[model samples]
Target: MKTLQKITVILTIGLALSILVVFFTTSNAVSSGNETIIRFGHGAAESNERHLAVMKFKELVEEKSEGKMKVQVYPNEQLGSEAEMIESVTFNDLQMVAASAFSQYDQRISVFELPYLFDTYEQAWQVLDGEIGQEVAEPLLEDGLRVVAYFENGFRHVTSNKPIEEPEDLSGLKIRTPEFPLSISTFKAFGSNPTPMAFGELYMALQQGTVDAQENPIANTYASKFNEIQDYLSLTAHQYMPLPVAISEEFWRTLTSEEQEIIKSSASEAAQFHRDILRENEEEMISKLQDAGMTVIEPDRDKFREEADAVYEAYKNRFGEDFVNNILKAVK
Candidate 1:
């Protein structure tokens, strides 16, 4: 009977040890299955559309992945300037980023920055969201980047401390432009001194009179409150700014095929959301700018177009006449 009791005791202890082992193993597996986190960076104020769109992307991506993925956003150059962020993506330091095509012009994405190339937002979207946009993404792929979507930044306008009623009014003025060669050339064509400065430094430069003027979308001007320091706004719409949403190729390749689909789907949905918001808010943005004491001027667009002619002539070889013609055709 004592022998039988010993066998029972031993069996009980063995059962307890087996249960403990399974419990610990299961706990470790659960911990190991936690979601991956992605950091998305951009160079815009929190209140700006670009920042808002990125937030929307985060929401969509997280929701679509059912908590299997997460996104953390860094706005207002907390990560760094646009150029810096792009480099971070290349080095796998940042997982994703959204930046103006102009900021990436030096990276050979300047093909999208040709002045007067896209006449309207729709045409620009068709070209950018379609095959040509995919082509533009090709170069970045070689640099360890993946383009997901293009968000419309809208048409850029000139805001100056002086009243600008015509192309001639731009003469001898120092205007702050993006550090893109094409942008500098565009302002130079109108005889303005183009100063390439980071967007974060622009407000101070204008306030201190370091620059006589700067150009941006009306919404951006209003959102940034640039109208407070500037007296005049010319509705030149000379350039169409588009923000390309990109991810680090290395990070992207690490994901499973299903995971990649989830991210791409979420990004595409967020892109459309941003476009819708811009369309709805455009008129209100213009009204807000006018209310802020900015004298809005409607100059003879043809004259401005005539001045921008030289930009094409100088860049035709680099951008190719056929490419330029394709853009014009898409807009038409």
Candidate 2:
């Protein structure tokens, strides 16, 4: 009878130990299995505002998802260039990218490239955060891309070897522009010789006189050290550029609705955070360019706006008046 009791006790203790082992093994498997990984790519260097926003996005997503999702950022074209990144994300080979030149893929995005579009940052934000952004972004879903947020590249300005105080001053000057039709068109309308080139080749293009000038946001100008090669920085504020945070439709479909909302909300918050940093540092950038021996020109903005009529007509013909009007109405 004592021997039987001893056997019973041993069996019970063995079962309890096995149960404990199973529980721990299952818990570890669950912990490791639930994590979803996102591979994000962007063209900006670490010092650029675009990359800074990307870092903020990583933080927000990780915090909100409670470690269920992990974001891995590849900056400075480590994964690929802007256009290449967009293509990868669209096919879902890459989960996400911060895309500045994605208009080449979807023409609807080209609307933001229109010259003299927004007079102020406030006006740009109103349109971007409202119906116009939604209207423009909606079509991207069909192309296997989802615009998670509209982040700022800020208002683009012109950097020249000489002062560009008026449209005539830009005449016949070789200006490097991103390989976008609207960007080329904008400079063409201003009577400049617009050369479409990759961003990586720009500094050399300017130095070698392959291009005489270029246009980008103030933050980009400073980050690229255009002040060293270029003599003048013109506050053209020609295009209030919006860099899209894009996710692949395939990857997006895999996410739960709750995960999607967390990502979307995180992107929007990061965008605002980026814009605030840019605004606070804009004057400082301009000052730094001046300190670096570049001439800063604040041209008659009205003069630049006046030349945009033909450009507007051309865009209206391409995108339709209704589409253009909707964007205009949003700012008001």
Candidate 3:
């Protein structure tokens, strides 16, 4: 009886040890094989469509990877302004950023900001999704950033306290613009004094009359409720703002080819979803702005186009006439 009891105790001890070994091994495997976390940052308001698209990207990546890859988004400049965020991504301090191309104007990516460059969104997409887009992406590689996709930033329009029936209406008005030189020049061509300001401070600036007007997409104008302080919505559609979805090249190169492919595919898929949503909701955004008591003005588009020519002439030499001509040819 004594021998049998000893045998039973030994067996029980062995079983407990086996269970602990299995648990430890499984835990180590999970910890080692866990998906990498990518941090994405942007400077748009939480209520903006761009923010919503970021959320969608988060969901899509996680679902496609079965949670093996995760996207964490920082909105409302939680990271910094667009230019700062781009610098962060370039240094690998941040994994990803969705920033307006205008912020990189000094880098020559702002060539896209030339007025009336895109007659239609489709034409813009073809240029962005093709060889020209690849060429533009090449210059950014030196900054340690890789372009994943081009997300729609929609067309830009002017919002001011006074009505803008033509370029004359913008004369002497102080307008707030992004930090891009092209944007400043474009406003200048229209006879307005452009002031560069951060997106966060724009509302207060308008309220305090620090700047009399600003330009942004209908969605942004409505989402920020800029319509409240501003009286007229001039549909300038001067520039097609393309939000470049970029990843740190250092981080991207560290991934296995398979992992890189996964992320690129997921980003492309999410970008299309974003564009579809924007197009569907554009009309609704117009309606909402009208309901919010903002007067929407459809100006003589041709006049606006002609005024934009001055901007092209001024910057073409700097951007390389070949690059400019190629882009224009691609779009045409």
**Model number with the top lDDT:** 2
lDDT of 3 by residue, 116-228 (tens): 99888888888888888878878788778899888888789899988888888889999999888888899999898999988878999999999999998877887788978
Model 2: per-residue Cα lDDT over 228-272, one tens digit each: 899999998988788888998888888899999999999999999
lDDT of 1 by residue, 1-332 (tens): 99999999999999999988866432122222578778888988888777788899889888888988888899988977787888878877788888864345334466677777777777788888888788767777878889899876878889997777778999999999987888899999999999999787899999999999999887778877898899888888888878888888888878889889988888888888888888899888888888877788887878888899998888877667786676556666
After superposing candidate 2 on the true structure, give the runs of residues whose Cα lies further than 4 Å from its correct spot. Answer: 1-32
| RMSD value for candidate 1 | 10.0
Minimal lDDT window, size 10, model 3: 24-33
Q: Model 2 misses residue 83 by how many Å?
A: 1.6
Q: Provide the overall lDDT of each model, using Cα atoms, as 2-decimal numbers.
A: 0.81, 0.86, 0.83
Best by TM-score: 2
- Candidate with the larger TM-score of 1 and 2: 2
Provide TM-scores for the models: 0.85, 0.88, 0.87
Please identify model 1 stretches exceeding 4 Å from their true place: 1-32, 101-107
